[model samples]
Target chain A: MVIAAIGIAAAAALWRRDGAPAVGAALYHAWELFLFIAPSLLAGLLLAAALRQLVSPGALARWMGAESGWFGLAVATLAGALTPGGPMAAFPLVLVLAGAGADRGALVAYILSWALNGFQKLLVYEMPLLGPDFAIMRTLVTLPMPMIAGYIARRLPIAWEPPK
Target chain B: MTGGQVFLAVIALVAFGFCLRRGPGSARRAVVDTGQGLWKILPIFAVALPMAAFLAELIPADAAVAWIGPESGVSGVVVASFAGGLMPGGPFVTFPLVLAFAKAGAGVPQMAALITGWSIFALHRIITWEYPILGWRFVAIRLIAAAPLPIVAGLLAEAVVAVLPIGLGRP
Candidate 1:
């Protein structure tokens, strides 16, 4: 609210100063941001649904339920790969991961990484859009983020009790 | 599309259901009937493409960088995150938006951060789609957890670039 108010105020001020209309750069930016985000959401939803139907959750949990370690991290990442989309992408997978015995911390790890990248999304959307170089570079760097995320989730200091 | 391939997809899906099956599988039955294959899912993506195109018309690339670029790191991170969170659509246009920032002298940090912001952190989707289905608790958890993803993704991406075998150094 504060930022928007300031933005509007700045635009108003500028409009008053110059002979132009009150529309300003901030408003334009706000508009741009909105336009840019729409299509992918649609695509992600489509893919997410496909994923849910493809993989069964209980089996996925068994796979992901490997002993917690770096090995655990690999399992989570691979589970994420086999699973499609993020939390809201598909219903069954996310629910299965949550309900079918995937630990909360590991689920978080999977989700954070899963939500970010995967085969279909990267192969079709990102790698093509950003190009192979960008995709590969991003993959190399992000490979570690999930591990870090998974590690942090396991070592969580925050006191939220795990759901029974 | 071929009969054999359809046979394979079906076989794979059935195998998947039998092995890892949980949640709605017994009820839903089979791979072709799985979550992604439903007819109900295409509307959002179609809607998103036009909306994004219309939006980009308003905010040019130079301007986005000015507001969310790395010159102001903390503010940059926050703004980029929110911008991403606020959108109701796809990263298709956001990709160009990131490029726009980079073209306008935005740092790799800002571009990467903006991309992170754009991913799954969207606010409109959360409100309309996720909230009703999952409730506020999960929604809130996702939002709070995703808050810094953009910054972290950006910083780490930069770290990778700096140390790439090709290296980021001048020739």
Candidate 2:
């Protein structure tokens, strides 16, 4: 609501300066882009929600627990990529993993993987606007990043202070 | 639309069918979840997309190129990475702005850095989601571990662009 209001104000200001035609053109382009994106967004959200429901937290913990090692990190990364929704879905799962005794390394890998290479976001948003080449290149380049970060986090003795 | 779009559609369909086979209840729940997600995202789209278009209109192509285009070099990537982290909003907002930047002549490496920074270091997400849920210690460690990523990714992307043919950078 706030963002929309600010946008409206900005558009009105732009309209005053650039006149009606330019603003109209901009709006038309936005609508066109929206039309192209809506289906994919709907589809991606559906898939993400279904997957979220299907993958139980207990199962996630078992796969990514402290003793699970390198395989755990790999599984966590893959799961992070596949697990859908935004931070609301993700952070909760992180909490669940933490509570269920998942390894810190696996947790770090999971979050980083989701942040960098969320498959659903790529499918729905990135591929459409940025083109497949950019998307593919970005994906390939960032693929190993989470594991690298995970290993570093694992090696570092950063104190895990519990939340208030 | 594009091959990627078609591929995603097919994947969504398969997933939908699988959800249905699991049970009618699960399918219905998924649909409900989708609706809620759409509700949350649509307003951000409404604001961000038009704003992106407006930004493209306001910022001249030459200025965009000079600042973040192919010749802008490492500094451009650094600027883009920081700008991306500072950008507030989700994928619906950020990706459209990225498209706007691309249209206005930002380079592939810059865009790569932008996305990388947005994913890992977005301050808004860190304050709201990461800190509250995961605690400060976890957030700090993750930030330190991930700090070099965007710069590294940007440099690697630059190297790739140098090796590839002319049009490969755009599409």
Candidate 3:
């Protein structure tokens, strides 16, 4: 609602001089971007749906464990890889997973990866925003972020459960 | 089937799956219920799609590039990542500004770093959305946990490009 109001203000400001055309132009531009990512977003929705049904959070946490010592971090990174939303989108899910007994390290990892390095974020958002080489390189660089996040969470004072 | 056809089929299947999940109702009732849920959101999507396009058009790409492009280097990456912390809006809002940067001579590494930073490091979002809902301790821990990840992402990308053979110029 607040966001819509702001958009209306912007559109209205632009409208003072020429209302009809400004809205049309803005609408057209929005359409183009939507057209670009709709396929990917729809697919992301489907995959999310699949995940909701197919895997329990505990099972997801367990499968994500790659190294015995670094298990939490690895699992988090893997979780990060598949998750498709930006940070805001990823956080609640991270909390839910943690609530369900996912390791804190993994939760941090998943959160980092959820926005910075997910397959969907990379493929859909990054590729277009930064171009292929840029997107590809960034993904490569950030690959360790979630793992490192997990590692730090494991070592640091942060608690896995929400701070009461 | 072609990927397109397969995708269409999947869409249909998802709808059917949704119907199955709805329970012992008539097929007509199930379809109506499902349609109503979907119908509610369609107009909002219809409106948002273009507004983003205008924002994309309004923001000048060259300026964004100048501020956070490859020329900025590691410091640039750190700045970009943290600066990204203050932005509001979705990936849709975020990507266009960064895309503008990439088009204007930003390095691949830096470009990647900035985008990653922008998406995840948003503090406004953390405080506004996550904190209020989750509480002080949870929010603080989450934010504290958040800081180092983008840096790690930047450094890791650098290391991978250095150690692994990751370029495309054949001998």
Residues B1-171, candidate 3, lDDT per residue (tens digit)? 224324533754675566457553533454554345345434555544444444444455565556655456677667766766666776655665454344444444454555666656666666666667556655565556667656666656666656643321100
Kindly report, for each predicted structure in the order presented, the TM-score of its chain A compared with the true chain A: 0.57, 0.80, 0.60
How far is each candidate from the true structure, as Cα RMSD in Å? 9.9, 3.0, 6.9
**How much is the lDDT of residue A104 in candidate 3?**
57
Tens-digit lDDT track of model 1 for A75-160: 66666655554346643455656665565456655655665665445533453334445555666656656656666666544444
lDDT of 3 by residue, A105-158 (tens): 666677667767676555444443333444556666667766765666666764
Write the number of the candidate with greater lDDT, choosing between 1 and 2.
2
Candidate 1: stretches off by over 4 Å = A1-58, A85-89, A154-164, B1-61, B69-78, B96-106, B128-146, B162-171
Q: Give stretches of model 3 more than 4 Å off.
A: A9-29, A38-44, A61-68, A80-103, A115-140, A157-164, B1-45, B90-92, B96-111, B128-146, B151-171
Q: Which candidate is the best by TM-score?
A: 2
lDDT tens readout by residue for model 2, B37-90: 788768777788798777777667777898889889999989988887898878
For model 2 the TM-score comes to 0.86
Q: State candidate 1's DockQ.
A: 0.12
DockQ, candidate 2, vs. native dimer? 0.55
